[model samples]
Target: MHVVVIGSGIAGATCAESLAVAWRNQPEHRITLLSASPMLKTVANFHQLSRTLETFEIVERWLDDALQYPNLSIVHATVASVDTRAKSVLDTAGRRHAYDKLCVCAGARPNLIATAHPEHVIGIRDTESVKDLQARLGSARRVVVVGNGGIALELVHEVQFCDVVWAVRDEHIGTSFFDAGAATFFMSDVKLESAGMSENESTATLRHGLPEEPEETENGVAIFTPHTLQQRAAKAALASARAGVSDIPSSQAPPEPNQTAPAMEVYSGAALGPRWQDQARLHPIGERIDTPRRVVELSTSVSAVLSPAEFVAYRQQHPAIVHNDTDILDWPAIVVLSNNRVYGCDVVVSATGVVPCADFIGPEILRASDGGIAVNDQMQTNLPDVFAAGDVCTVQWPTSSHWFQLRLWTQARQMGAYAARCIQAAAKHELALLDFCFEAFAHVTRFFGFKVVLLGLYNAQGLAVGDYEVLLRVTRGHEYIKLVLANGCVQGAVLIGETDLEETFENLILNQLDVSAFKDMLLDPDVDVEDYFD
Candidate 1:
């Protein structure tokens, strides 16, 4: 049996590792890991925080360490398309790789607001894109961050020494993760948040610092770096030649009139995972300022992205706002928000959301409304012998009451491992039950320098307004806890800071115990909530 995994991201890597370990004794079976970039993301030092929540550090390893499996082989190539009828994948290099089973973990791409202006409008998705943003920020005096997602939230907090114009469509920040109350609670800390990286981030920087250029040793070990210009040009030339079009001189060339672009035209490196911002420096170039350096513009979105020349003409017909109106001309670009306000800035970072990278996937495969390939409970796609996991795939099964799908690393890792098990079971003609991890939704992340743990319908997702009761325990600048209760049972919770209530809360959600007797005591800091039921 042969399995071809199309991506070396967290999902693909985890699935590959699981299969390799399960089939280590079976030498006949072969596994192939395909990646566009040479560097493969691997999960390390994994810790299961709860039944549904797991935490791990993402470690980027080169080919040297990736070749540990004897039965598995890693191929660094960009896939052009997958021919389900032929049971093969065609790479940009015009090579066909045949496989008995296929897993499309191709991951996702950033949904940039301004697709036309790539130079001034940036979307941070991977190591390459983040590096590009860092370069532009080096000389930037002001930057506009647009989005209400995690990337936008983190960028607004991490960036220092330069003014940031944070534009959000929602009235409050972090609409994706937090409710209005939670957002307001975090807002208190946002003003005083430190510019320094977290301790884990500092260690990751020291341990796996990326180099400016690839440094290959005599033994073949090399420090990983972004694709060089020469390599990129060669790929572009190959693609252009395949399309029968002349090579364009400009780096950002448009496709030949009426000519279809090559398959590799939309290709990108692997999607970045946890701690990506740690290594990708976001500090803007300027002297440190004692006061906060951010302007929050709520309930607005970017209506248009304009160059300086366009902005000069635009200001005559519209209005532009800046602290120093005289220096507005110095900005490289101008952003016009939906609220009729305009601001001039050097760069605009769009962290809006992501669209699944399913362009290479054929139309025969069924896709969800969100554009990701839809998969069943077994992680099997609509086509037999084809599977998909991670951000590239959406779970189409009937989910548990408290569990839901989100494009998060925790869910990605879980889906990958479970997909491997399903594949193994299918090969053996056995049944694979839904994994317990899907019983409830749990995620652990950080925001505003505080530990955040979300479990089981956090933020009252999908619940009707005023249908559920909420309880809160807050300590200004320290901790914030919110619990969702319905019908005398704990339905969901948002625990922030070092509250140490995750274990008990997780059990409460899973067990669905009637806590109505002590519901009020759940938020009592003095009382041991865990001991009440014990």
Candidate 2:
């Protein structure tokens, strides 16, 4: 039995590792891992200034174990297409590899604004893009940032030398991550002259390219390091525990060894670590003396990105237009917002979002929300003996009422491991049960220097116009908790700060417990919500 996996991202790499380990003793079962990039990424110790702006160093230690496994070989090449009928995959190099099973985890690419100039605009989706932005930011006095998600939020905090004009389509900041109330909580940080204390500036030299050649052991294990801002926080609970802090924010306890799988490695384009903002030097934009500390333009988006020629043409038509302190011809890109406003900036950061990069598998036949390939609960795609996972695939299975897809790393890791199990079961002609992870949705992330925990339909996602009641508890700059209940049952929750209610709330949503009688006391500071549920 031969299993071939395409793309060395977290999902693909994880699936490869899982399948190799599962079939390790079965030498007849051959597993081949194909990577487009030269190396893989590991979740390292992550530091944060705001929730999304983070930093970390890469580790090559993971490959030592990966290569030691028997009957597993790693290939470095980009897959071009899959001939399902022929049961084979052809790489860009024209080398054909036959497989009994194949998993596509090509991940995604930047979904930039349609009007943004290709050269003047850059999307921060991977390491290369970050380097490009860093190189461009060197002399930039001002920049226009478009997007409302993690990348945009981080950039708002990290830009010290440049004035930022943040334009969002939403009414509040971080609409992608936080609710209006929490968004307001973060807005305060935006008003501060500078966030996170600056330790004398430490220079970060971007690695030129891929690291040293893969070192091979006698056992045939190959090891190498990745060069990128590609980041996913690895140790939070452990970090807090190791630091001897008992107040586990968001009730996030580190998963036991048995529950944790090999960390997903990725090439992550334009991705930044948790500390991308806090660690940056907070140099104000001296060129723009009048620019405020921070400006958040809500309910707006970049309507157009014009080149110097286009801006010149546009200015001729609208002679009375107000302008920022920039020469329209000198700027790389000029942005026009929906409010008929034009601003010239050194460059534009299109941190909008991403779309699946499944073109390698031919025109996508199976589709899901957010341009991901739709897959059943078994992680099986419409193609026979072929599967998909990670950001490239979407869950089409009838999910638990408490769970919804969000295309996050946690889901990627789970789906990868689960996809492997489903593959194994199909290979052996046996039944495969869905992993328990699908039973509920639980996520722990940090934003604006607060531990943010999301459980179930945290933001009332996909909920129609229904009688959804909310319970709120807030303390300025300390913590915020909100619970959403539809009818009389616990449906979702948002936990910020050291609420320590993550576990209890997860159970409430998963178990569908009716908290109608106790709703008022759910967030009572003196009431032990866990004990009450217990």
Candidate 3:
């Protein structure tokens, strides 16, 4: 039996490796790995410089060990399409490779914003782009970043040369992974502000001439009038740009240098259009909206009022109106925009998100549904004999009601292993379908500064909501502990600014233990739960 695996990312590599192990003693199965680029390279290379560099070396070692398996083969080619009916893949060179089973692990590509100029935008997806960004930043005194995710935050911290402005459409940064309070704290430290602004509060507002009213039912969050937040964000960006030009203190200043110079500013705004609240929950850190003076609570309804339709349409109707014109486009000598053209800048880096590149899997083999490939629990595509994992396949997380695809590397690796097992099982006599139910859990543990960790599913319902216990402590700083429990069983937890019992907490989550006996210990910080395991 021959199994074909596409892609060379974490998921693909893990799946192939797992299958090779499964067939190690059998020696009857043959594995073929194909990729568009060299194997083991970082996926988009947007990670830390050290991590990106190490990925290449790690992948090379992985491949070397895998090649030792006599039945495995590796091919370097771009897959053109897959014909599920024929059980074959066609490469760019028109060479067709047949397989008994195929796993489509083709990952995603960077999603670029339409407003960005392609020539000025550089995506940090490869080594070349990183080099280009470093070179561009060497001379840049001002830089504008358009996204507000982890990558954007990391970039802002790493690139110290110039004035940095982050243009975000969301009310807050890290909305998905953090709670509102946490988001506010992060923004406070980072010094971010929301874009857009409003006029007199008494006046009736109209976004694209549609009468606007506060949305009260959802979250009761404060709403920024249309254009108000964006305007404020734009102004902040302009201030940073202006500061970049004038704030450089002369070399001959006081012996004790003046420490009151204004710092580089970052402006954030939510994209206009229908707001995706659910998407916000998926972020590893929760989200927040930033104002010039302070972080603010934004009403969910505010998004409905400031929909992207009106914003984009308004810009379309009034071409002369632009945000942060003085800083971004229309500044006199420092910056200039002529007919929507920018003259300055060595390079523009695009830190936009990514989208699955599943087009290579022919339409017949894997039909697109709702912008993602529909897949069964076994990770099999709609067509027979073709399986998919990673960003390409849309698999529902067992815990969350959301049916979106799991794009994280962790999920991809697990799905790949499961898919390989299913394929191998299918090759033999009829076997019982494995239980598709797998808990969707995510957690993070921060060490050194504050030991912070989050586990299990916080977004889902019907599991354990109020039944869980929580402990809040205020000592030197603050410590928060939350646990999820169902029928006295410890499901998951979140611990912040504390690590005395982290190992015990992690084991409880991993083992899915019934903590009924130790229910009283949940509140006691001194209790050593690790002893219970022993």
Candidate 4:
């Protein structure tokens, strides 16, 4: 049996390694790993520059360890296309390789938005591009970043020297990861807000009158409104009208002076002025605002309602009142543009996220649907002897009718292993389809900062309100712990500034153990949760 795997990304590499292991005892099988760039050189480049450099290095080491198997052969060549009917792959060099089974894990390319300039974009699709971006950033002073994805924000942090201005259409940053309130606070700290005034209708109102003789300020530009400007205008207008009136005789005289129009009330409050307003309007959504005594406790939720009409209404109803203005002109700057162009910069990098690069397989073999390849639960496409995993294929989980897209490294690795197992089972007479379950799991542990792990679907339906439990503890400036429990087992947990027993917590989640007996103890800070696992 000859098996061919296309692409050498994490998914493709995992599939090849799994097949080699499965066929290790079977002498009849031969496995070939094909990639456009061989020698694993690209992996090294990614390790040197990307945010997950260490993670990439670990993965490379794993791949190298897997290559010790005798049945595996690594081929360096670009795959031009695949023929499902003939079960063959054509390389760019015009050489054809036949296979009994094919695993398509070509990974993805950079998904550049139409508004972005492709020339100025830097992405993680390849190692060469990352290296080039590193070189460019060495001298860049101002960078305009576009997008609200994790990579976009990560780039903002990674490029320390270059001022980053992240452009986003959304009202807040990290919408996918944080709830609106948390996101609001997070964005506030990072100075992530909407850029340039959202249309005129979206601009806030000014309740007060404009001041005469603009006050000159040192910083940027400031617009000031005098405290009594509105009152003075109203009085002058009333006096002028009264004098001009050849009063239509005593009888018609405007119902006496008692019926005079009510005086206009001018509001006096500090406001975000015109220049600052313009800055707010034009600035990107994910740029950080560094201030003295950064406060992290303030939390505000992003409103569930997000529509252009709603935005317009909010602005019309709540115009910003200008009380005072200050200059931010001296502050470090990052310029963001819709198009790809470099003005003055120390670094120019692209935050283009990954996209499906299934060009290796002909359209006849795997048709594209909704910007992705359609696949069944077995990760099998319509084409025979062909399968795909990771970002390329979609799967329907038993929990929901909606098909989920797997893009994470862990998911891709699992899918690749499953595909290899399915293929191996098919080759043998005794093959049983394995029942696989897909659950959405997202976990975050910010080193010494905070740890948050979510399992299953927190926001999904079908969950009984009382079926879940939440445990929270704040140990006075030292530690904060939170846990979400379901059916007496650990569903999720959030830990801040402490992880003494994280492994034990993780084990409880994975094993789905009954914690009913220790429910009280688990809530106690003095109690050791690890002993319960024993």
Candidate 5:
């Protein structure tokens, strides 16, 4: 049996590893890992940078370490297309590699800012884009950030020294991660609420703390603090830098300097650590005054990205809020919003989500509207002998109540390992059960310096309002815990800070235990909830 796995992302790499191990003793079986980027990013710990909403980063690189298996080979090539009829894969170099089974795990791309000067925009998706962002931020004094998802959240919290004009299309912050209630909790921190500010008549919440960037202060003098995740990842990358990078990038690139973009441009795009935020300030008013912290602007969307000339014309039609006569302004580009607001900043960041790159093969491929190849429960695509996993393929199977697709690394790893088993089963004509990882959605991450564990239906996601009753606990900047119960059974929960209720609550959700009589006391401050359950 021969298997071909496309893209060396977490999905492809995991699948390749699983396959190589399974076929180690089978002399007739072969596995090939094809990648566009130079090295595979192995992610272990998952957390957003500085806990404002940034996502994750890498641990270490096993750089061609898969090659230790004689039957498994790593190929550096850009996939041109899949010839379903011939059961073969073609590369940009016109090379053809045939396969008995093929898995497409090409991930998603970043949806960049729509602007005329692609040169002035950056979408921080991969390590490459982030490095680009860090180098540029060193010289930037003001930045215009667009989007309300994970990326935007991280930036609003961590980008120090510069003024950020954060624009979103929602009524509250973090539309992608939190509801208005949870947003309220985080909003308090964003506004720098007093440690004694009265939280909701409900749950208490605690915040986490500082590390370092080995960063320079406002005076351009570098300072060192405690070791940060960024520092550790940098050291690891340097220690195991891949010998050579492939010519093709995993996604699109920013236009080179001096290039003239004729029109507004866009493309799909494509992590963090701590003290990461101390030096950085989140001043929306663009001033360093001692007044009240700025309220985060919401429900506004960028209408246009303008050059200096366009900005002047725009200011003529709709005057600037605070006029300046300086011949040279702080920003080269001006972002105009739907609310008729204008922001001038050094660079614009587009955190707008992603669309899968399922078309790396062709249109004949079965794909979801979001551009991910559609696969059945067995992880097999429409084409025979072809399967896909990870962000590149959307699972079309009937899912369990605890599971839903969220385009996360967790799902990618799960799908990849499952796909490998599916391949083995198909080759042997054997039956395989879906991995239990799909039975429930369990994720462990740290946000705002608190351990965040999300388990099955964490937000009562698909249930109608008022259908469930909520139990609450709060300790004023120490902890906030809410449990959703329906028909006396635990449905979901939102745990902030160290509540120590996750494992027991998860068990309740999975076991579907009735706790109606004890519901009111589930979150009681003095109750030993775990003991009661045990």
Candidate 6:
């Protein structure tokens, strides 16, 4: 039996690894992993925080180290197309690899804003793109950021030395993760400063980004933190020393024991998720004079991106138009917002979101309305002996009442592992039960230095209008918790900061317990909600 998997992202890597673990003793079962780039994304330091909540770090492991299993072989080449009829996939090198079973785990690409000036717009996707952005930020004085997703939120917070103009379509920031009230809670500490304002008019600038709500300290308390660069270097040195390689860089860390090293290119892999910015220096060049300014334009989007020449012409035509500085023509890109506001900046970052990479797939395979390859409950596509997982595929089957689709890393990992089990069952002509992960929606992430856990219909997704009630508990700068209740039962929740309510709430959502009698006491600080439920 031959199994072929495409892409080396979290989904592909997890699926391939799960298959190898399940069939390690079966030498006859051959597994071949095809990747466009050499780097393979692996989950490291995974911790099961609760029944449905998990947290992990995404590490870019070399392809050589990833081939830890004897029965697996990796091919490095971009996939040209898939021929479902021939049961084979053609690579860019014109070589066709035949397979008894094939799984397409090719992930999504950033869905960038349609702009006439492509060079002026940058999208954060892979390591290379991030490095490129870091290089560009060296001399930037101002930048325009577009989107309301996690990426946009992170960018607005992390970016220093350059003024940032945040253009969001939603009424409040971080609409993708938090509602207006929750958004207010997070942004409460964020000091908003208008661009091009006089020193007297501008309030004393607080921190350049959102205030950190450290778990160990109260709101106004101060704590010293270790230097991240020195810590990273120490870790790298330790790894090299353990590998018997003295003074070696972390990027050149040795392969695992008993594994043969394979030659591969660097930084050509799929998109890097989560804390990719940590790997690169995002600080702008030169010493900053004043605190960097952040302007939030709510309920607005980037209507157009003008080139330097176009911006100069427009500025000349509309001399009275409000702008940050007099020398606006120096900026490479001038972003025109939907609300008729304009800002000239060094570059425009479109952190909008991503779309599935399904163009290479043939027409025989069914696709969802969102352009993702459609798959049933078994993770199998319309065609036989073929499957799809990760961001490239969408669940077409009816999901759990509390579960819905969100193109997140956690879901990618879950779907990949579950798809492998489904594949194994299909190979033996047996039915496989749906994994419990599909029973509810669960996600763990960090935003503005606060740990965030989302479970079930956290945003009341897919629920009927006026069918659910929401409850919120906010500690100003400490934590924010929101619960969605329907029919007197907990349906979803958003737990931010060190709430310690994930386990109990996960049960509440899963068990659908009626808390009508004690609904008001759910957020009572004095009440032990967990003990009450127990």
State each model's CA lDDT, in order: 0.74, 0.65, 0.47, 0.46, 0.63, 0.74
- Please tell me which model should have the higher TM-score, number 1 or number 2: 1
Residue-level lDDT tens digits of model 5 in 116-225: 77778887566567666776676666677777766667776666456566765654455545444455566545643211124431112212111124342322222222
Model 6 bad stretches (over 4 Å):
193-268, 312-322
RMSD of each: 15.8, 15.7, 14.4, 19.4, 13.7, 13.5
- Per-residue lDDT over 448-477 for candidate 3, one digit per residue giving the tens place of the 0 to 100 score: 234545555332233433444322222324
lDDT of 4 by residue, 1-534 (tens): 999988676667777888898789887999988866543311222221111111222123323444777899887778777878888899878989899988887766554433222344444334445445555555454555544445554555444443554543333344333322233223323432232223231111010112224343212222122223234334333422332211111110011221111122111111111111112222223433343111110111111111333434543554541111132222222222212111222233334344466755656754554345655666677787787876666554343311134355545655766777777876773343643334334333232123333333322223455466445454434554545567777665544455465556655655678886766566575666677666
lDDT tens digits, residue span 310-421, model 6: 7768667766545545766677788876555688888888777766786677788899887789999999999999999998898999999988878888888888899899
Tens digit of lDDT per residue, candidate 2, span 1-534? 999988666677778888888988898899888877665543456343222122334332233344556778888777778888899999879999999998988777665666535677777765567767877777777688877777677787777566677766654456555565566556544453211112211000011111123332212222111111011011222322332223212211112111111122233331233444454444542353455444454445666789879887887887755555455677777887754557778778877666777766765358875568889988899888889998888788888887777666656666778899999999989758987778777767677667888777776676664356555666768887777778677788888898878778877887787777767677777777789888
lDDT by residue (tens digit), candidate 1, 107-137: 8877777444667888777777888888888
Q: With candidate 6 superimposed using the best TM-score fit, by how many Å does residue 62's alpha carbon deviate from the native? A: 1.8
Candidate 6 has its poorest 10 consecutive residues by lDDT at: 250-259
lDDT (Cα) of model 5: 0.63
Q: Report model 1's TM-score to 2 decimal places.
A: 0.84
lDDT-wise, the better of 3 and 5 is 5
Query: Local error of candidate 2 at 350, Å?
Result: 1.2
lDDT of 5 at 131: 65
